[model samples]
Target: MRAPGDLRADARRNRELIIQTARTVFAEQGPSATMDEIARHAQVGAGTLYRHFPDRDALFHAVLTDALERMIALAETTRKQEGLAWDALSRFVEGCAGLRLDLLISVAGSQATQVATTPEIGEGRARLLKILDQIVSAAHDEGTLRHDVGAGDVMGAVSLLIRGLPTLPTDLSAELKNRALRLVLAGMRTDPAPIPPPVPAMTANDLIRRLSTTGPAKPAT
Candidate 1:
């Protein structure tokens, strides 16, 4: 496989610049940020940007793939920690709540989000789910997580929280985000009688479908 170090000096620089510039532009302009704008911000020509990322969906795929890889690493680290299983799970979940929240919010809130679900995105999501399942199984074994709720339930609940994030006031978003997350965890506790008929986790396909449908379209100029 071609490694980062294998890239020629200019090619590597251009690739890195495009991703860096796109991150900032996408955050500020949402998923509607254009390739020309990203290319300009990166001090590269439109041709250069296209050479690195052929299209908008491809750019999003690269950005989200990296974000998902980071999250997977975080989850692996948290899972290895020695503590109450719930605590470990909570740490991973919290990290996930903030990890790429901005990027995903923009993608999910965009009108063209359906096209953003590239194969790379799907693979990243699947890997994440596998890691989550490992942690969830441990939590259940330790009597921390409710026996009835599976990893899918956790995934589904988090999805609900993420979908609502854009609607909240900017100032209160973080607070409400934390509150919503805590509530999702609280419901997974073994203390009270667990709710029956566990909520299914959102599959990679389901997540893409849901996100693609969020928010109204930007009005035509």
Candidate 2:
């Protein structure tokens, strides 16, 4: 029999391949893409796939958690640069917008049920939000963002844009997305008059918990 270390390494390699294959397959075929498909793509057996992920929800939660962790790392790196916080915020927004769009689209099209709010996913999301809060707070202190706007508002704007992206023509989509983001950013600049009170910002846990409750994506008109 192989040594324990060798077995562990082999298991780790298989898990990595499974995740990589799942990401590509999900992107191409949406969430309805089957475990069999993923296993075939990864060149692994169904038994191995089952060993790694018990169900579609488990797989999706893993994918989302991985994505969130990467975003958190990106946000932290951007935050460290001593520059206009808006610039850092804008970079993070631009980088993550496509990722968010892909994930939402996959979820919408997938056969998988709602993702479980696993603790690891929750913690990753919370860390991302914390970094975002830092960026937003810096912008507020610098008087770049309006007094009333908060980190949640910025993130919500990104989500709105992502949700609308699938509706635009392929030729016009990229350009329009940038233009729309610019318009929203301009709107967030300091204003002379006090704006009406906005809704309270959602906590990181609130955001993660609500993902499972999202309704089916309406057909684009």
Candidate 3:
């Protein structure tokens, strides 16, 4: 495949549009989503979609990469613009929630394991984690965040909370996710109680290592 920079302006636009539309369709319809459906949603021709992605795996890879890049950009922007460390961290988390990353993962199923292990995705994950560690450390220094928690802890919590119930209505699931995030954020704040966490905090590097070893979750028979 040609590098994006090598594509003509119109080709690049079509490629981006197809990837964005596929992200939404896959999140809603899972791995069963068809190339024809993606093309329809993207308002592009079948040939256009194929020309850009060639196949579902290709499209899925592009969508995941795009999401990671967007999250990295959001974190960088939040870090630069927010005056308070807590505010920056919160804003970045909120933006990630909006990206619906859990939904995309749900859609990918076992394919997620393959795509995540790719060198590009691995590099992107590292970059994002590095930025998050900076934000978490800043919050710690400011005394706004609990000293026991690390960037990995924050990411792990958000991942759990943002995963919506597939059976629930979309609006209801989103509402519950928001409420859960609020509770988690509150819990992460320093409390008067001096009780230490049961387990040692996992740093960003630890998280990366753990994820590298993780396989796709087995489906319930």
Best by lDDT: 3
Give lDDT tens digits, candidate 3, residues 60-143: 778888988988999999999999888898888778877777544666556766866789988988999999999999999999
Scored by CA lDDT, what does every candidate get?
A: 0.71, 0.69, 0.78
Q: Which residue pairs does candidate 1 place in steric collision?
A: 152-201
| Candidates arranged by TM-score, highest first | 3, 1, 2
Kindly indicate the candidate among 1 and 2 with the higher TM-score: 1
Give one digit per residue, the lDDT tens place, for model 1 in 1-221.
23557989989888878887776677656777789988888999998888778777778877766667877898888878847667777787777776644565566544446545767678888998898898888888988888898878887776666555544344344555666676677778886334232235436786455446643334311
User: Which numbered prediction scores highest in TM-score against the true structure?
Assistant: 3
Better of 1 and 3 by TM-score: 3
lDDT winner between 1 and 3, please give it.
Answer: 3
Residues 1-221, model 2: lDDT tens digits: 23224558789788768877787677555666789988988999999988878888777877776677768877888888749887787777766765553664456632433463567767887888899999999989988788788888877887677654454344345555666666676677785233222235446775455444543334421
Locate the minimum summed-lDDT window of 10 residues in model 2: 192-201
Q: What are the C-alpha RMSDs, in order, of all predicted structures?
A: 9.1, 10.5, 10.1
Decreasing lDDT order of the candidates? 3, 1, 2
Please provide the root mean square deviation of candidate 3 (C-alpha atoms, Å): 10.1
Candidate 3, residue 112: lDDT: 64
Query: Worst ten-residue run, lDDT, model 3?
Result: 192-201
